[model samples]
Target: MSSSIEDRLRDAMAARAQAVQDEGPPPPLPLPRRSFLVLHARWTAPIAVAAAIVTLVAGVAVAVRDGVPQRPVAVAPAAALTPPFYVAAIVTDHTVVSKTVTATTSTRAPLGVYDSRTGRRTAELPVLVDSQVAGLGDGRTFFLAGRERKDAPLRFHRITLTPDGKIGGMFALPRRDDLRTETLDALAASPDGLKLAYSVNTRKPGRKGEVRVLDVVAEKVRRWHTDRPGFVDEVTWAGNARTLVFSWQRVEQEIGRETRLLDTSAASRDLLSAKPVTGRTTFFAARPGGSSFLTQEGGGKGIPPLVEFSTTTGQPLRRRIMREWFSPQAFDSSGRVLLGIVRGGGLARLDGERLTLIEMPELPQGERVYLETVW
Candidate 1:
């Protein structure tokens, strides 16, 4: 019976092999007790399908664990990524003379006389009112203008100091009625100290205000006629004291200002109007011997925070976005600029490209530093 059974099984296996050979080559035999033991089963097609599904699942899991993505990261806007700048030391101080007080007012406001070389306060003068003052390069003489009395005329005075911090001279200016209805805005002295520029504003009942310029050396006065009424913000001597660069704006509830460059020798006024595209602009220092003036441009979006332009050509020289409240106070002989940067309660100096902290030494417990011209 066993032989009969074995013969039957062998004959069945032989018949299967013959059928497979008739079709093509016989299928490869997978060896048992090896890595491919399960592949030898008759259900090899189903086992291969299961293995392919498992491999795909494992690949997806690895990608998720490693946090790999199919796309790239986006970039941010340039303007939003820009950093802020702080001021360092101002190089305008070339000398410091002495540390002395010649006079002190009842209000305790000492008139400080500074020597640019030594960076010292040489003398101080006491005056009645808080006056608008201008210093002469000689470091001894000063020009002050303010209201004389409650309803009286505006008075101009010349105060001079001796070498020993003594009051050398104090004289009143010539009485003038033209300045009665107007306010004094700016005063600039010529480099030679022989000439001075005075800007005054006058108010009319029903018309725009008028601004006039007086040349003390030439003893001449000229009125600037504009479509808008405004005050002269600044007056600066250009190349040779013959040309003057000034800035003014129409006074309204809304601040729209314009800066102009005037040539007293030409007898024709050259106007550079800052369009109302931006907000109110404050004129700072004008570059010596150049037609360009530095201005702080405020208001509107996408506009630079600071800009320097040629008042004659209306060409922009340099534009940068630095701080909100700051101005170009002075420039050294080497062309380095001294900037006054106001942050919170204190002011600092931005010298060239460095930031230097400043402390006011006059007031009691008052360490606030402001802007002043050195030389």
Candidate 2:
């Protein structure tokens, strides 16, 4: 062979070797089973490629640049995420009586603690008048709001639970005279228990809706007001305590409902300045210390009820809900158990795709209603 031709062939081989080095090694392969080589020879290559593909698809990672040190993604192990064992339920009843043109009304809400596994009421607190309740991420600390009657000032209290799921203590929050007249439509506590965020709208004509974030320890508050006469509901916090997700609806305009994300870290006080996360959502619930949240779609007969969504993009993360499950209210720490209300005034737990109706005892007669539940 000519010297020039030999040199060209050698250079071509060297270029091909460098190209292979640039494309890093293949993804780690799955461990092989006990099948010996006697089973099949030709199938080995195809099976190995299939295993590599599975590894690549299942593993999501960020691209690593040369000499850049990236922190390893910390994924909470399934074993560490424990299912909630105790549940705090708010039970309420309203009655009205009319006697020969004279009418009277009464309202009462009783906070009850139940064994989540057995659906048995372990303890009950005395009735709280016209009350609303929200739980801190710790699963034991809760906040309760109550009022004497319609158009009356509201009072706030902090509730603690014993290890056995009984009421441990109840203490009143430092009163702010400005908050007495405002009605709390929705409330959520930060995962770290450092702050409380709530939406208050009186619904009086020409009044705008407002959202407030109060620093629990500091007792300082920051307010955000809507541009128009609107109200916010279903207020929930993302795992990163700074972001809040809620549904906004303007009463003056016919713009329907919009799910919005508000960053409390920002200085702006205008609520509308926050961006919309999803389109016209009626309800959504966030998992404690989780990066995802659950949102539901309306249905009549054949539609799936719940969809897990990424809190960052408001995009559906997974779709594995059964047709029977509906109105998801809370999620266990590991997000494996979804607690929701089902037909006939009972609670249901959705573990994976299987739905189990909790065996609950009958409540005391006299028109009972289940308002809310949390763990």
Best by lDDT: 2
Q: Write the per-residue lDDT of candidate 1 for residues 58-177, one digit (tens) a residue.
A: 333333333442222234332221101111121121233457634322222434554332334555544423245554434456666667653556566677776653557978766433
Which window of ten consecutive residues has the lowest lDDT sum in model 1? 81-90
Estimate the TM-score for candidate 2: 0.65
Q: How many backbone clashes does candidate 2 have?
A: 0
Q: What is the Å distance of residue 225 in model 2 from its true position? A: 1.3
TM-score of each: 0.52, 0.65
Task: Give one digit per residue, the lDDT tens place, for model 2 in 55-145.
Answer: 4433322222353433435555443332333445445565566665544343434667676556677777555444566776345777776
lDDT of 2 at 253: 79
Deviation (Å) of 1 in candidate 1: 99
Least well predicted 10-residue stretch by lDDT in candidate 2:
56-65
In candidate 2, list every pair of residues with a backbone clash.
Answer: none
